[model samples]
Structures are given as C-alpha cells and as structure tokens.
Target: MMGLLLSLLSGLIFGAGLAISGMADPARVQAFLDIFGAWDPTLAFVMGGALIPMAIAWKLRKGMKKPLAAGAFDLPGTRQIDKKLALGALFFGVGWGISGLCPGPALADLAIAPGPAAIFIGAMLGGMALHKITVE
Candidate 1:
C-alpha cells in the first residue's frame, strides 16, 4: 500500500516536472532535437539540471539497504549492450526524432493535448504489444 502510494506520488512529481519544464510541448522537444536548424538548447539545460539530482540519487542508492516504500531496491542488473538493446534504441531514437515525443512527456501531454497524446500513447502501446508477440 505504501509502495503504491509512493509510486503514485513519484509519478505525479515527475509528470509535474515535465509539464513545468515545457517538456510536454512537442514543438519545444522538436526544436531541441533540431540541431542542424534553429536549435533550442533549453532541453539540454533541462537534461543537465536532471543529472544533478540523478547523480545524487545514484550516490545515495549505494549506501541504502532498501527503498523507503519497497522491500528491496529493484535495479537493473544487466549492463550489456545486446542486439535487442541496440535495435530498441534505434527504433526509440527514430520514433522520438519523428514525433518529438517520448513516453514520459507523451503521458504528461495527456492533460494538455489529449488528442495527439492519446494517439501517441495508443501507438506506443501497440508497438509494445507487437514487440511482446514478436520479440519477447
């Protein structure tokens, strides 16, 4: 119960951050990715800002025995760059480049622009289902 509540709180905080940082705006993300054209460096700064807290969290995780709301620290055990990973990354990059939206911001955009966001989310889920059927 606590873990679920914590997860909800964490998600809300993350979504709020995405909204406040203008990450929910697809045009802003597209502009940021447009390095060859009228490039926007705001996303770079947002990423840089995110790194600070991420770094701190990484450092803190080393000393922690368990998470606050969970029984154990559930972290990724693998660090290998396999074929599946590469292919997935390529697809993700292509999708992001074309749509200017990723999972996090796309979810956040649901409140702001439901039409586009819902379409993106639907496609994303479809892709996931297809991947599960074919790959996994």
Candidate 2:
C-alpha cells in the first residue's frame, strides 16, 4: 500500500510538473525542436531544472542499499552501447521529433485534449505491443 501510494504521488508530481512547465503543449515542444525556425529554448530550461534533482537522486542512490519505497534498488544493470539500445533511442527521437510529444507529456495532455491524445497514445501502445511481440 505504501509503495502504491508513493507511485501515485510520484506520478501526480510528474504530471503536474509537465502541465505547469508547458510541456503538455505540443506546439511549445515543436517550437523548441525547431532550431532553424522560431526556436524556443524554454524546454532547455525545463530539462536543466529536471536534471538537477535527477543528478542528486543518482548521486544519493550510489550510497543507498535500497530505495525508500522498494525492498531493493532495481537499477538497470547494463551500461553497454549496443545496437538494440541505439536503435531504440533513434526510434524514440524520431517519434518525438515528428510528434513533438514524448510519452510523459503526451499522457499529461490526455486531460486537456482527449481526441489527439488518445490517437497518439493508441499508436504508441500499438508500437510498444509490436516491439514486445517482435523482440520479446
């Protein structure tokens, strides 16, 4: 129950951050991506703001035996730069560049604009399902 509560709280914080940071708007994201055409650097500030807390969490995690909300630290074991990782990153970047909506912000937009958000989420899920069937 505690773990579930923590998860919910974490998600709410993340969603609220996305909404407040204007990341939930595809137009803002696309403008940030548009380097040669009316580029907006606001997202860079948001990314920098996020990195500060994440960097601190990573530094703290190095000394922790277990996460506060979990029995053990379930960190990724791999540090390899393999084909699969590279290809996955490429696909993710391409999708983000094309749609201007990564998964988190896209999910956050669902409450504001249901129709397009649903379509994007549906397509994303379909891609994930396809990847699962093909790869795993």
Candidate 3:
C-alpha cells in the first residue's frame, strides 16, 4: 500500500512537472526539436532541472542498502552499448522526432489533447505489441 502510494505520488509529480514545463504540448516539443527553424531551448532547462535531483538520488542510492518504499534497489544490471539497445534508442528517437510526443509527455497530454494523444498512444502500444510478438 505504501509502495503503491509512493508510485502514484511520484507519477503525479513527474506528470505535473511535464505539464508545468510545457512539455505536454506537442507543438512546444516540436519547436524544441526544430533546429534551423523557430527553435525553442526551454526544454534544455527542464532537462537540466530534472537531472540535478536525479543525479543526487543516484549518488545517495550508492550508500543505501534499500529504498524507503521497497525492499531493495532494482537498478538496471547492464551498462553495455549493444546493437539491440542502440537500435531501440534510434527507433525511439525517430518516433519522438516525428511525433514530438515521447511516452511521458504523451501520457501527460492525454487529458488536455485527447485526440492526437490517443492516436499516438495507440500506435505506440501497437508498436510495443508488435515488438513483443516479433522479438524473442
């Protein structure tokens, strides 16, 4: 129950940050990506803002035995740069560049911009399903 509450709270905070930072707007994100056009650099500040606390958390986690809400830290096991990882990242970047809606922002946009967000989310889920079906 406590873990679930913490998860919900964390998600709410993240979604709120996305919404407040104008990241929930596809146009804003697209503008940020549009170099040589009417480009916006506000997202860089958002990224930097998010990175500070995350970096602190990571640094703090190194000295901790367990998380406050969980029994143990479930960190990623691998640090390798392999083909599958690279290809997945490339696909994600392409999708984001084209749609201007990555998962977090897309999900945050659902309440405000339902139509396009739904379409993007549906397509994203379809891609995930396709990957599950095709990949090992």
Candidate 4:
C-alpha cells in the first residue's frame, strides 16, 4: 500500500515535471532533440535538473542500510560495455530521435494524443516481445 502510494506520487511528480517543462508536447521534445538543424538546449538543463536530485539520492543510498521498504541497493552490477548494451542504446536513440518520445516523455504525452501514444506503446511492447524471444 505504501509502495503503491509512493509510486503514484512519483508518477504524478514525473508527469508534472514533463508538463511544466513543455516536454509533454511532441513538438517541444522534437525541437529539444534537434541538434543538427534547429537545436534547442532546453533538454540539457532539464536533464541537469533531474541529475542533481538523482546524484543526491545516489549519495544518500550509499549511507543507508537499505531502502525504505525492502531491497538492499539493487543496482546493476555489469559495467562492461558489450554489444548488447551498445545495440540497445542505438535502438533507443533512434526511437527517441525519430519520435521525440523517450519512455517517460512518451507516457507523459499520452494525455494529449492517445492515438500516437497507443501505437508507439504497442510498437515498444512488440520490440520487447521480440527481444525476449530472440534473446532466449
């Protein structure tokens, strides 16, 4: 129950941040992503804004015994830059560049345009399914 509440609050805050930053609009996100033609550095600042809190949380987590509930520092162990990592990043970048919608931003934008959101989400899920089947 507590975790569910926290999750909802977190999502609300995330959506609020996206809306406030104008990232919920695909055009704004696209403009921010467009570095070659008409570049916008708004996203850099937004990213930096998010990073500050994340850095603080990372430092705080290091000192804590465990999280508020369960799980003890469940961080990724692999630091190796392998083909899988590179390929995943490449695909993610291509998707973001073409659609101006990363996972978080895409979810946030769903409130405005359900059609594209539904299609994009379906494609995303399909990719996940394909990856799972192929990886196995």
Top candidate when judged by lDDT against the true structure: 1
- Across residues 1-136, which tens digit of lDDT does each residue of candidate 3 receive? 9999999998888888888878888888888899889999988888888799999999999899999999999977999999989999999988898899999888888878889999999999999999999995
The deviation in Å at residue 68 for candidate 2 is 0.7
Show where candidate 2 strays beyond 4 Å.
none
* TM-scores for candidates 1 onward, in order: 0.93, 0.94, 0.92, 0.90
lDDT of 2 by residue, 20-47 (tens): 8688888998899999999999999988
lDDT of 1: 0.91
TM-score of 4: 0.90
lDDT of 1 by residue, 1-136 (tens): 9889988998899999999878879999889999999999998998999899999999999999997788998877899999988999999999898888999999999998999999999999999999899976
Clashes of each: 0, 0, 0, 0
Query: Candidate 4 has which clashing residue pairs, if any?
Result: none
RMSD of each: 1.3, 1.1, 1.4, 1.5
lDDT agreement with native, every candidate: 0.91, 0.89, 0.90, 0.83
Off by over 4 Å in 1: none
Q: Number of the top candidate by TM-score?
A: 2
Q: For model 3, how big is the CA root-mean-square deviation?
A: 1.4
The 10-residue segment of model 3 with minimum total lDDT is 14-23
Ranking by TM-score: 2, 1, 3, 4
Backbone clashes in model 3:
0
lDDT score, residue 125, model 3? 98
